[model samples]
Target: MVNQAKAHIAIPMGDPAGIGPEITVKSLAKAEIYDVCKPVVVGHTEVMKKALAVTHTNLEINEISEPEEGKYEHGTIDMINLDNLNIDHLEWGVVQAQCGRAAFQYIKKSVELALEGKVAAIATTPINKESLKAGEVPYIGHTEMLEDLTNSRDPLTMFEVRNLRIFFLTRHVSLKDAISQMTKERVFEYIGRCEEALKRLGVENPLIAVAGLNPHSGENGLFGREEVDEIKPGIEMAVEKGYRAVGPVPADSVFYQALQGKYDAVLSLYHDQGHIAAKMTDFERTISITNGLPFLRTSVDHGTAFDIAGKNIASSVSMEECIKLAAKYAPNFRS
Candidate 1:
């Protein structure tokens, strides 16, 4: 029976060629995971079995057609069996069209389950973009696929590690593009959204600190004018409108300050700015929570480590944290 108090989180095994299945198995091996939520793998049954052998894990795979059918207990992994992989042709760490297609199918099924409210949230594994291309899937990454699937416009990405939370202003773009996109209106817009996003995570009256574009927050226009010109003005607008926003705080210290509990979250100006901070603090525990979706979604910050695909040495700490974070926020975020 599905536990009424526990959220149902769907985990889409990443690229069949990568460590997604392996990590999924390793993460679920812990009994503590069952204590928090009911997690069901929304991927291939055969791939999971292969992962079992790779991890040398002893657990029963309970195939279920729906989330409610899951046992949601320790020593058992309940799965929604897609039965899609051709186990004979499966090779670890290689980009294959079949693996890409299977990966996409898993994500699609996961989205369906979440949209139907059968699952409270989704904790996704990594997917290979090269394999996705080879499979003729048009989407470049998880965010793009999720935005389209959920009919969500510009999904918000938040990185949470320990007590620190961060939101990106721009990602997957060159440094030049990121700078140009940081207009006052854009910054102001994101601050408001960031505040709302934090509120969804159950943060009360969040105080958001906007990271500076230049050193020392431009040092009163000495280092760079982005802070004086674009960033500060944007923050002022948000403050005027009753949002508890501040800075163009010096990038070097803003994150540290947030970690120290001075602010509820930091709005990072670019991808590397926030990623570096989160990963550097504790790489394996930095989980990416995708806000602004109909249902909550959390993912591991790392990618499909193709080189370590079948290697049992791959760590499952990030995967476990991803599922736990999804469970943690599911109650507050879900409809």
Candidate 2:
């Protein structure tokens, strides 16, 4: 059980070239954010300063050498300056190996903090896959990188929202590649993770709906047999295991039902299948949770928004929501 003391959250600066710094600054400008919990940014202090100047947000930026020295004051942003990057060569709207490497450092430090119990949870901004690849991280995104760093092999993706928590059994793959990657064991493992995640989110008895891979849930195998051979069997096994699970439901309707509160969450077969639905339904207000991690991690559902990187026009709604969710779940992180 977590101590009821105020939890400190570490927000990793995503890609430096992206809008991560700007959004982080904007998110900290709100005074109420510090009221719930203490937030310490784990990234380059110069990059954050640049973001603050770009956004023209009048908030104060406090650079602390460690998370414990952070001042939990309103209108002030305290950061654990990794000092890993030189902001001189970063170019907006382009991917750079240096930025990627620096982003990875920020994440590594945040994970270290959680493991050491210096912070209660980790909240991250979105990082670019191309930047990460350029940096030679050897993984697609944060989830995979975290999995590798922690030596976890389970199939895990970002879970968004509570009422309609969504999971991607296959992410960052072509439609064809995704279909090839779908296996019964992988599907079952995702279901198991979803079940455990929901219970952690405070649902005593959660109901999960698994979406079909093909049109009309394979239209009874006319469209595809994955539903019968893979998805349905996984659902059945989950149900037999005493979890309230259902589906191989049509992908189109499963999300509709989820939005209407018919199910606690939906396990989607691929990336766009779940992400597109959730983001389309609620773009600004959605929350992204990285499940199967050793500690609770949540982040803004949107990306770095390079197009609007320095304009100060980026919205902080998602970041604010992420902060709130981190605080709400901070009590659940076992320390």
Q: For every model shown, what is its TM-score relative to the native structure?
A: 0.98, 0.92
lDDT of 2 at 7: 86
Tens digits of lDDT, candidate 2, 214-255: 888887789889888878887887778787888888888999
Q: What is the TM-score (0 to 1) of candidate 2?
A: 0.92
Judge candidate 2 against the unseen true structure and give its global Cα lDDT, from 0 to 1.
0.82
lDDT of 1 at 312: 95
List model 1 lDDT by residue over 1-335, tens digit each: 22369999999999998999999999999998999999989888888998999999999999999999889889999999888878899999999999999999999999998888898999999999999999999899899999999999999999999999999999999999999999999999999999999989899999999999887888989988888889899999999999999898888999999999999999999999999999998999999988888889999988899998888989999999999999898889655
Clashing pairs in 2: none
Residue 34 in model 1: lDDT: 96
TM-score of candidate 1 relative to the true fold: 0.98
Give the top-scoring candidate (TM-score): 1
